[model samples]
Structures are given as structure tokens and as C-alpha cells.
Target: MTLAFDSAGLGPGFADPVFDSQSVFRSVLNAVAYPGAIERLAHRPGAPEGLDPAMASVVLTLCDLDTPIWSDAALSSEAVSTYLRFHCGAPLVAAAADARFGLIGDAAAMPRLDAFAMGDERYPDRSTTLVVTVPSLTEGPQRQWSGPGILRRRTVAVAGLPDWFWADWALNQGLYPLGVDVLFACGDAVMGLPRGITVKE
Candidate 1:
């Protein structure tokens, strides 16, 4: 789909749109290809004040008019809404369950994983992809992660999450091919936590 162009409504995105988006898209692919492995984000979009750099880059690279977005309390500011609308032309949804992409800035208060779209049994790929911004990538409880993307098993620690997050992850993972996937962003780095990944605490 063609991205809606706005000359005056939103802040500018990539300087070199095609090349820059390709670069960021590569990073996003790598993140999902190697779950729990941090991929350095590329591009420097003129993101809104509260939007995280990595999440913003990912949104610009992956989102379009077809995707609907949901923003958490910390990221639902008017500036962010206007920016995303103008740059991405994506519909902003009020309910988390309806969003194809959820931008979360407050991990502690974000909705549970099950609250978002889990897709249908037949079209499991229709699930939501959460892009959550946290404080650190390596300063939380360590858990052993293993799945399609992992070589054998990888130990990962993510900071700035609520205590119940892992419990939600466990349940989400139990859904096998039908569940929500997550992209954890810290600073300018992103790490994937696909539904296939098993986390052993």
C-alpha cells in the first residue's frame, strides 16, 4: 500500500525514505530471526517526544495505512497520535485488542499480553505485534530462551517490566502458533520475543 504523504501535517520521517526504511527493516528482520538477540536500530525519524527511538524506527519501517496502532498511556499523547497519523497514515485504535501494532511506553502499566489481538485459530499470523519501550535490555531477571530463532538456548534479561509479565508470557507461549509477539526496545536496540520462544526462568 502507498504511504500517505503529508507535506505539512506531521514531522518528517527518513531523510532518504527508501534506503533508510530498508536499513531499519533489515534490523527488524534480524531481531525476529534471532529472538532475544538485540539488533541495533537504524534510521533517525523525527519521532514524537515520548516515542522511543527504536520503536519509532520500527513503526516507520513496518507500519502503513493498513495497520492499526494502539498506544499505551505513556505514548498516547496528542503529539504522538498526530505524528503517527501524518507519517504512517495508520489508524489509531482506542482498544488494544483491535490493534495490529501496539506501541507501549510504560511496561509497568501496559495491558496484559492476552489483551491484544491473538488472531484466529486459522489465521494465526494476524496477531498483534507489541513494540514496548523499556529501561534496560540486560538488567532484569534472567530467563533461558529457546525456540526457532535461538541456536540452542539464550539467557535474556529485560528490565522495567511488571512482576506478572512473565506469567502472561508463559500463557501466551503456551498458545503455540496462535499468540501475540513482542519486540522489546531499549534506547536504539530491539529484541524479539516471538510466541514460539520458550522462556525458562
Candidate 2:
């Protein structure tokens, strides 16, 4: 499928009509390797208005026909959705529980973490992955984080989140392997929290 990115109404000065997604994938690995540290983001500017370069980069890197995606209501537009379908070949999902990748373009609109798919005991790796795009990446009101990816307990103050997610995240930690993972994107930077993360209030 050919994407008419030029006519998609993206802003001026966006070069490289099609972005190379492998770079972002590699960056994701680095981010996961060192939890609590922000990983630098890189993307071609001028992506469609609703779709940030960082979010788009992740979509490109991970999406395929096998991946079922659930887009946030904020970015559930025909143009953006169609572009993703054509470019990434990702199948849109009607139910969050059925989605392998849930794209939360607006952090505020994100559903409760428990509402998403947490893998079953038989296949703990089958859980959904949330891709949350926040307005800022800087450390906000710090919260403790510790797990496999972390060297020690780290503090992160994130923006654009409600009180309930932290509560849900805290609960999810007890579920062990039967929980969802998360990836946070801001600008071109990305970070991750696997189900293993033990968050402390």
C-alpha cells in the first residue's frame, strides 16, 4: 500500500516520506535495558498532527498484520488510522482485551490498566502492551519503581496521568507474569515498564 503522506496534511519541513523504524526499535531496547532513564527519540518531523513522531516511530517499528492495535479515541481518525493500516499493516481491534498493542495517543484518555489484556497463566507473554504518549518526558512527582530492568528503586514523576493508573499498576505487580507492559513516549524519546516492575507508593 502506498501512503500519501505528502497530502496527509502534515506540517511543512517533514523529510523522509517514509521513516526508518528499526532505529526506534533499537532505542526501545536501550530504554528497556536501563529502566528509569529516558531514552533519546529520533523521528522525521511533520508527521500527521494527531500522530507524534515518537508514537509514529514506535508504530512503525512494531506493528504488522499479526499485531492487533487499539487506538485512543483522540487519534481514531480515518486519515491517521488508514495511514497506520496501510503503512504498518496493523489490524485495528474493537476490544482492548483483544489488542496486542494499545496506542494511547492521549494519556488522559487511557483506560484503567486492568481493563487491558493481561496474559493468562498458561501464556503469560500474551498480554497487551500499552503505548502511552505524554506531553512531557521530564521527571514529575516521583514514584518508586523497581523490577528486572531496574538496577535499584528509581523515582519517576510522570505527567498526564490520573491517580487510578498508579493504583492499578500497584495491583498489577502482584499478578506477576499475568499483567500488561507499558511504553511511554514523549517527543522522540521512549521508556518501558514490564509487568515485572514493582511500583511503590
Candidate 3:
């Protein structure tokens, strides 16, 4: 519902916006820099019924007035839409490919990596960044990934994503600088899966 959600009505975002957002932003950067590494969110913000703290923290930190956002059915509730609009002031796009930021509360049923915007050759940085909410980041079958941030290889076990995700990921990674980047969140933890990282089944 609301933050503090208590009688006082603390509000619906980081208690301390500046400090909290910086912390979460740093965590996000670190997660992306070191693929497969799990980063726990220190700031737990109040969010809608279907949204979790990790996803909330991410949206509050990354999405802004200039970005276009898209969400799957699992996160397309009126409450969630209201929360995103109120907190981020970002426009909600109808198609995933039109969004600069995509939010998925149901990773199992989410669209393929190709469904989202893959920045064109010249402006590869314009690609969409997907915030995917999963069941757990510490439990499940592990996949080995190696890339820019990783020294050699790192193993990660993110539970709940469908098998097709990994398959689609291979193609995504193959696109290198042209594909979408992903942040896998569960509870208060987030794991990054940038475009450079290659995951071996």
C-alpha cells in the first residue's frame, strides 16, 4: 500500500531519498560491474502490493522523468502503475521495445530478450534495462557466466526464470553492445546480467 503504511504515513519511497538512492545506485553499479555477484539492497522502500523492495529501490534509483517504462502483466496493476508514475515520473509505454526501462514481476512469463529495445548500432547505450523480479537469487541450478566485469567465471543460481530466458540470453549476449541489460531481483537482493556476460548452460 503506502510507506510507513503506518498511522503517520511515512510515505512511499526511500525514507531518505538522497542517501538511500545513492546507496541503491551504487549497489546497482556494483552488481552490473561484477556479473553473477549478488548484491543485497540496504534500503527497503515502501511499494505497492505486487512490487517488492528490490524492484522498488531500483525503479526509484534508475527510472526518471526522461525514461519510458514498460511492465509485464504481473506488475501492471493499477497500484503498481500509480506507484511508478508518482515516484519516477516516467511515461509508461505500451510495448516493451519502446521502453528504456522494463519491469517484470513474473520472470517466468516475461517476453524474450529480443522483445525489448536493443539499442541500434550507433547508439547501443539506448537499449532497455530490465528489472526482473524472481523468487530467489541464491537457490536453484547455477549457470556460469564470464565477461567484462568478471575476471574469469562466476556461478549464479537465480530461481523462477523460465528455461527460455537463458536460451534467449545467449542470443542477447551475442548482440554484445546492442542488447538489453538485466537485473534479477529477489527479496532485497539483485544480480546483474549485463550484455557482455556470456552464460554457459
Candidate 4:
């Protein structure tokens, strides 16, 4: 049997799998807990063709064999697919509804948040977690956010999102505990937008 390690355009994975993942995991947690605060990723994993370094680190930290991922056309290249399979052991799914995690290469072209797997009332934790690649986290239209993890209202800006993204997020917020969570990546930083967060544009 010939074992192939040909990853189309995929680059190297984590330099220190265990420690790097642990560090990335902490950043992810801080992002989620602080909602709009930008958390800089300490790990610099090799990113695939269409993915950014921050998003790639997030996938490596959170995805695994148990997670099913959905990616947009720009991010669905063989390089990204093979990279995820080899490093994270995550399976790729065609439909967003079936994915535990969704990777969006172009935030402006991303599907509606409702298109993803919104967990049921019984198990709201089963909803999908979206990892969207954006141009910049600190350079865009500012929005005020208030939610569970936030101490008070926080103003933050995220570039490269569609014009209707705020509107769509408003609708998603109405879904309460049954909606999908999102993490926006820019360069080596990430910002979380959990379902509990409410955004005012």
C-alpha cells in the first residue's frame, strides 16, 4: 500500500502540534468570552491556498475526526480539503446544514447564517461554528455589541463582510440559543461572535 502525503497546495501544519494547539485554543476561548475583542493567535500554522493563518490555526485547534466541515467554493480547493483531512482528521461535507464547522474564505460571498446547522431546542450546543476570513478586524464599519460574555457594550469593526451581514446577524440573534456561532479571522487575529451576542450597526 502506498501512502500519499501529496497535499495539493497545502503548507505545513502546526510546528508543535500539542503546545501550538493549546495556545491557539486559549486565544479562541478569549475571543469567545470577550465577544468583540480581537485575540491575536500565538501560533502561526501553515495555511492552505485560500485560507488565512488565523483561520487555519482555528481549524487546527477546534476541528477533529468528530467534526464535519463545510467550506465555500473559494475554500473548497483540494489543498484545503486535504490539509484538513491530514491535520485535523475532519471530514468535508457539501451542505452547510450537516457541518459542525463552516469555513468561509470570502465573507462577502458567505451564505446566510441560517443556512448552517442551527441546533435544536434540546441540544443547542450542536449548532455549527463558522470560521470566516475577513480583510481586517479593526478597519470597517463599527458596531456596538452586547451579550453574555461581554461586561458592557463594545464597539468593534470587521472588514470584508457583506453589506447585509449585520441584518442577517440580527435575524440570527432572534434564534436565541439555537443559532450558529461565528469567528472572524483577519491576519493572525480572530474575533468571536457567539449566538448570545447582539450587534447594533
| TM-score winner | 4
lDDT of 2 by residue, 1-201 (tens): 886546445343224534555566778888777766788866544456688777777777788999999988988887777767766778998899999999998887688988888999899988898889887766556788887878778887677876678888888888987999888888878888777787776
Can you write out model 3's per-residue Cα lDDT over 70-167, one digit (the tens) per residue?
Answer: 99999878788878888888999999999999999888899888999999989999999999999988787888888899988888888988888888
Whole-model alpha-carbon lDDT for candidate 2: 0.78
TM-score of each: 0.93, 0.88, 0.93, 0.96
Per-residue lDDT of model 1, residues 54-145, tens digit only: 88888988889999999998987878888888778899999999999999999999888889999888999899999999999999889999
Better model by TM-score, 1 or 4? 4
Ranking by TM-score: 4, 1, 3, 2
Native-referenced Cα lDDT, model 4: 0.91
- The positional error of residue 122 in candidate 3, measured at the CA in angstroms, is 1.0
TM-score of 1: 0.93
Worst 10 residues of 3 by lDDT: 2-11
* 1 or 2, greater by lDDT: 1
Backbone clash count for every predicted candidate, in the order shown: 0, 2, 0, 0
Tell me the TM-score of model 4.
0.96
lDDT of each: 0.89, 0.78, 0.89, 0.91
Deviation in Å, model 3, residue 17 alpha carbon: 0.7
The runs of at least 3 residues in candidate 4 whose Cα sits more than 4 Å from the true structure, single-residue gaps closed, are 2-4, 7-9
- Once superposed on the true structure, which residue ranges of model 1 sit more than 4 Å away at CA? 1-10
Q: List the residue pairs that clash in candidate 1.
A: none
